[model samples]
Target: MNLALVFESGDYVLIGVFLVMVLMSVVTWSVVILRIIKLYQAKQGNTAAKQAVMESASLEEAAKKVQGMTAPIGTLTADAIAAYRNYRNTEAKTLAEALPLNEYLVSQIRSSMSRSMRQFDGGMTSLASIGATAPFIGLFGTVWGIYHALINISQSGQMSIAAVAGPIGEALVATAAGLFVAIPAVLAYNFLNRSNKTIKQDLDAFAHDLHVRLLNQKD
Candidate 1:
């Protein structure tokens, strides 16, 4: 059937709800796609910063190169470098003197990483909510449609398929609309979750390496 005909044939209220579902689906997918792109870019930037830090001769040079990168890994590296520089400048005689400074820097890096993670995690909650509730919303439309269909049958005292088909078909459309909204949302939610995990892993690894490098510098 043509799109316009299907829509015109359906109960107006159900059609309205279906349109709303379509809007929600579009919004949810848009967020998923945008976030994925941002995360991918962040990942690529992190990789490049890691390589640069590993290859650089001195921590100061590495920090300078990475300072403007702004990705989580680069920011952590910069923080570590700053902490090491501060410790060296102070010319501490023992680990006791250096330990406090390093701890402070690690704290800063951790906070920054956490904030980045939260920012990346945006829109996931909305997607989850939509995935969970859309079916029920559709079911509500279906139930409404069925109720009206039965009311019509009672008033007309007829059992003909022609008399019943329109309302029943309209009701089923709600279920279909709900599934249409929900399926993509659920899929996107899962995919985005896995992507977030991967990003978190990379961030954790970078943080660990930076911690080790900072500790070694103190010795």
Candidate 2:
């Protein structure tokens, strides 16, 4: 009924299921912890970079201030500045270059934001996979364990409640283990997803302000 009994008495397939569940749980927690730390650092860096840019009175001053910043906002600001410069300096006209300065700048800044958000999406796919599949995997282990239990009982001809209950209970442990691995992954995925959206909103607002400043400031 306990884990020790399950491991000792269960066949190789059942044992393999347990080991796989353990590995999935380990991966889930590792990703959750690392992602949280990364997001925290990114938020702090973004806040500092936002303040630095806001305090600057001109585009040139903002550029210089954010030059050394490691935040996603710094990259966004750089992209905005580069887009502005490119639009101004391009004397040769092309179909793609026909867009207004604000539109061009907005496109470049949005691309930078996308790249930054993608970095935070590192382990999300795996978290989703584990959340979706862990329970089914545990059920497979349970079914396999019960099949072997039935086979053993058939050979021995012992149909007692004691014999039937013990193996079935042990088999159900795999399903329980699966749920244990899956629930936290699901919760963490939801939490991290919300956090990423909030960060994206902050970046979007910063990008908008930067665009307005770049348009208004005199060269």
Query: Largest TM-score belongs to which candidate?
Result: 2
Put down candidate 1 lDDT per residue, 1-219, tens digits, no spaces.
244544676577767777878888888889888988888888889889999998988777798889889777887787667766666677645654446765766776687788778877789998998999899888987887788778878899998998888668767778888888998899999998998888889888888787877777734
| Candidate 1: C-alpha lDDT | 0.80
Question: Per-residue lDDT for 7 in model 2?
Answer: 92
Per-residue lDDT of 211 in model 1? 80
Per-model lDDT: 0.80, 0.90
What TM-score should be assigned to candidate 2?
Answer: 0.94
Q: Which ranges in model 1 have alpha carbons more than 4 Å from their true place?
A: 1-12, 83-99
lDDT of 2 by residue, 53-107 (tens): 8898877778898886667888788677777877888999666568987777777
Residue pairs in clash, model 1: none
User: If candidate 2 were superposed on the true structure by all CA atoms, what would the RMSD be?
Assistant: 1.4
